[model samples]
Target: MTPLECVELQLAAYNERNLKLFLTAFAENVRCYRLPDMVLTIDGKAALGEFYAANRFVHEGLHAKLLNRMVVGNKVIDHELIHGLGPEPMETSVVFVIEDGLIAQVFFIPAKSPS
Candidate 1:
């Protein structure tokens, strides 16, 4: 699959809350970095499952809409707005590195817009 297709699949899995599909889109050893602190280096399917379970609560009913996407080779940067999880919607920028058709790493940075 093309890099763009891989990204699209990942987003679809996330939106549907299909954990198995979501995990399938990731590499065995995936590195996830949440800007400003959180970092998780997960290995194997079991570890990925654990990570998903731990974050499942935070993702309950959360929907993310991609505003823009820029792809350079295997790396994609997405700008999105997320809804349904908090008082005010949150905007975020995410960088995804796809390797061999699977997501190898992801970096998320939160943003605040002036009201």
Candidate 2:
């Protein structure tokens, strides 16, 4: 699949809460971090699977809307409206770096509140 297609498949798997399908879009040694700080929050497909297994179905009404998308080289950046991680929907941006047609790294950056 193309990089954008890879990200789309993962997002579909996520909404479906299908852990196995979700894992298919990622590399074995995938890394995920928060933007700005870039602190590694998840490492490897196994760890990511565990995280989703525990949290993916935590709440109902879980869905995401891609507000915008941009693809450059092997990277796919998405601005999204995410719901069900909490009580309210959040506007966030995620960057997916694809390598060999699998997501190698993901950076999730939630919109910051005004200071």
lDDT of each: 0.80, 0.91
Give the per-residue lDDT of model 1 (tens digit) for 44-99.
Answer: 65777786667643577777799999999999899998776687778999888898
- Model 2 weakest 10-residue run by lDDT: 53-62
Q: What tens digits encode model 2's per-residue C-alpha lDDT throughout 15-56?
A: 887888999999999999987888899999999999988876
Top candidate by lDDT: 2
For residue 33, model 2's alpha carbon misses the true position, in angstroms, by 0.6
TM-score of 1: 0.81
Native-structure RMSD, model 2:
1.8
